[model samples]
Target: NLNGNDLAATVGRVQLAKLESIIAGRRRVAARIARGLADCDGLDIGHEPEGAESVYWFLRIAVAEGAFSLSKVEIAAAVSAEGIPVNPTYRHLPAEAEWFRERKVFPPSDYPWGLPDYAGDRDAVYPCDNAVAAVESHFILSIHESWSDADVDDAVAALRKVADAYRA
Candidate 1:
């Protein structure tokens, strides 16, 4: 787990500034955050030969836009139970869930949320399936397709507020 100082070490003084750039939606600045995030290859979230860099970009933007963290499993479970389809990709994961517990990390949920009946098995595991990615896609699409920027902001605000209100 990355304590504040540990994270600080990995993220560095300049890196937090980069993260701040991501928060502010300067694409150039967000690129720095992405690079820093890439440093933690231990997490396996950084690799994607696919279009997922854009996905990462959206996540940075969304978080910058007001989104914050939830317990990854909780988020995955919520999205999965929402009929959004979950892929439990923990199999063959480089690190076990225990490794991530140090950081309270949520493993990613995979793409193509709201799977069809036949596709659940196909889409339900990591290496190919991811839980964080699933929840992220669902909400990002929700923001992109049906909402205004103000609506997206309100929604991000609402998500954070709801999470905060439920804090134990």
Candidate 2:
């Protein structure tokens, strides 16, 4: 039986020691950007739920439905073009992955899509899929533990610029 890999274990131990500081840095950067964007419009900044605290690794933002004419992909592309590390993190199933492709089974006994009779509504599937809905609506901005306040400001500024330019 494999217990664990020694090197991986060692690295995990080291990272665990620094975990608190790492989380703090992430939260600090996220909070700064949150404050900067508080009064801003046309975009919805990521937020924590009532009791949950987020150590935001990638500060996620959702472009409001009517806030801009651009789609999520376009918004992500624009943000990336601005030199900020931003990406749309989610990809819808089947359309984005071959494993989910129609009528493709790895083994005859097991169809990954399951029996056709069990298949649900295809048209309504994407919107109802949580992963699809999330990716369709939001883009993620990478944040680092070492980022300065100016870095946070600059990132937020670029986002605001894109939002304003694309605003409906």
Candidate 3:
């Protein structure tokens, strides 16, 4: 797929040269934030798997329904109000997507994949109750290599504040 722009190519090359260092910086910041929130209940912060290393594209947290009095939606708002760049990673798609706004049902010839001759039900429901619930409870934190230690600390503090306010 054609995805690059000529101007971006030049900048990308420069960034590529320092990619390893940038990744390291992000990891450091992520680790610090994780450690800061290690004791907090109800929050499941993202972490690197067994032997794999990540570039920290984005930081995410899962809210445990048993531990938190507030919902993921409420936590996101509380954190956002604290001036952090955190947002709910999950949301209801049919309510948010423009395509779904116009077409309430999915199936035979209703979407792009639906063909004219397809003998399928037009109002078929996609079974994904678990997936929908998971997405609705994930909170994403915006992180980057450019952020300073203070920034990470601030994010940690914001999370703690929200957790304290809504402990179950």
Winner by TM-score: 2
The predicted structure with the larger lDDT, 1 or 3, is 3
After superposition on all CA atoms, what RMSD does each candidate show versus the true structure?
19.5, 5.0, 4.6
Query: Candidate 2 — which pairs collide?
Result: none
Best by lDDT: 3
What are the Cα lDDT values of the candidates?
A: 0.38, 0.77, 0.78
On residues 45-131, what C-alpha lDDT tens digit does candidate 3 reach at each position? 764569987777778777887677777878888999999888787465664464554453564335633667767665555666766
lDDT of 1: 0.38
Which ten residues in a row are the worst by lDDT in model 2?
A: 121-130
lDDT of 2 by residue, 1-168 (tens): 157799889988999999999999998998888777776676766646799998887788877777788887798899889889988764546655544444445755335456576576543333347656666778888999899988888898988889889988
Against the true structure, candidate 3 has what lDDT? 0.78
True lDDT of residue 118, candidate 1 = 38
Q: Quote the positional error of residue 158 for candidate 3 in Å.
A: 1.1
